[model samples]
Target: MPYYMFQWKYKNEAVKALVQTPQDRAAELRKVVQAFGGRLHEFFFAFGDYDGVSIVEFPNNERCAACATTLTGAGANDLFRTTVLLTGDEAKAALAMANATNPDYAPPTGYTHHS
Candidate 1:
């Protein structure tokens, strides 16, 4: 499974709706995520740049994208973004792969540069 980090800011209409009738948004999100074969690990209400953030896991990128886009299709949020996340071990493995394949890759040195 692949993990994703999402941050979102609600539009004024969305804020009004939630305030008018506060509900468990996480539970609602879980329903949608489960339909897409994904799981919500954490959802938090935050301050500053983003109003909220969440971590989710899906079988793959396609499923993750589908779920995320569908959830935001209602025009409730003003700003929304989803980003892929890698575990420490996975990052280490990527570094090792880059090292192993370094020999086959070369940078262009045709242009002159002034120091």
Candidate 2:
């Protein structure tokens, strides 16, 4: 499974609706995720550009994209974005792979490689 970080901001209508009737949105999303053979690891509210964030694992990129697209198109969100997440071990492996095969290219002009 591939992990993804989903962040979203609520539209005014959605905010109003939640204020009037609060509920655990993660529980709602878990149904959708499970339907797609996915798992919702963590879900919580935040206080920044996005109102909430969730860490989820889906079978693949296609399913993740479809889920994100459907959610964003639901009209309940003002902002929505999904970011692919990599584990520490995965990051280390990527670094080693890159170190083994880095592209050699010349800089455009007056450039020096910075350590």
Considering summed lDDT, which 10 consecutive residues are worst modelled in model 1? 105-114
Q: Tell me the tens digit of each residue's lDDT in model 2 across 30-90.
A: 8887877889999998998999999999999989988888888888999999999999999
* Candidate 2 accuracy as lDDT: 0.91
Which candidate number would show the highest lDDT if scored against the true structure?
2
Best by TM-score: 2
lDDT of 2 at 57: 99
- Residue-level lDDT tens digits of model 1 in 1-115: 8899989999988889889999898998888889999999999988999988999999999999898899789688899999999999999999999988887765577866669
Candidate 1 Cα lDDT to native: 0.90
Model 2 alpha-carbon drift over 4 Å, by segment: 106-115
TM-score for predicted model 2 compared with the true structure: 0.90
Q: Model 1, which residues run further than 4 Å from truth?
A: 103-115
Per-candidate total of colliding backbone pairs: 0, 0
